[model samples]
Target: MEFPDDLKYSREHEWVLVEGKVATVGISAFAESQLGDVVFVELPGTGDSVTKDEAMGVVESVKAVSDVYSPISGTVLEVNDDLPDNTELVNDDPYGDGWMVKIEMSDPSELEDLMDAEEYQAFIAEAES
Candidate 1:
């Protein structure tokens, strides 16, 4: 329910924040709420190459196991290691500390295909209906 105005989102409920060629990825607040208390996270290592729409990691929560998808094609520059040990961060601050990975984008143009915040909100609304 708390969608940030600046971030782009995927139909799969992933959020992306692009800075220069780097893109930071995470599950949206909507995603975390649906999954319920996250218990563990399995993430790709730094330097891993991820393709758009591909599974890059898995997040296990009290309710379900969800795959974290890559929003754009890129090489992972960094991963948040703290999540596997302290999964609450994903619920408490999904846009900040809960961020899963940062990637050096392979194609910046791919960003244009993702939804803006308003569009993503509308998407969730329609999906929920």
Candidate 2:
């Protein structure tokens, strides 16, 4: 239920942390909680191109498998190499070590379409209601 103020969120439940032109992406804490305990992760490779609003990876939990979508178009600069072997990180530290990818954004303006922490909280509240 913790939505970090420094991050932007996508409706698909992804969170983004922008630094320079690179964006670090991860599922929000809400997404991880909803997915339950993560058991496996499939991440895009470094140098891979990811499109805005498209799935870039998958996270499988004890409950179900879910696609991890990208919130922006870009070339993947790095992927969290530990995720494949330590999927539990997704549940243990979703906003930190549980991060999925870091992309070099192809269109920075696309960030305008995402929500801030307050907006995302409202979005989640609306969905729940």
Among all candidates shown, the one with the greatest TM-score: 2
Once fitted onto the true fold, the runs of candidate 2 whose alpha carbons sit more than 4 angstroms away are: none
Residue 114 CA displacement from its true place in model 2, Å: 0.4
Q: Which one is best on lDDT?
A: 2
Cα lDDT tens digits for candidate 1, 1-129: 689988999988999998999999999999999999999999999999999999999999987999999999989999998999999999999999999999999999999989999999999999999
Error of 2 at 79 (Å): 0.5
Model 1, C-alpha of 54: deviation from truth (Å): 0.6
Off by over 4 Å in 1: none
The residue-by-residue lDDT of candidate 2 on 1-129, one tens digit each, is: 799999999999999999999999999999999999999999999999999999999999987999999999999999999999999999999999999999999999999999999999999999999
TM-score of 2: 0.98
Please report how far candidate 1 places residue 110 from its true position, in Å: 0.6
TM-score of every model versus the real structure? 0.98, 0.98
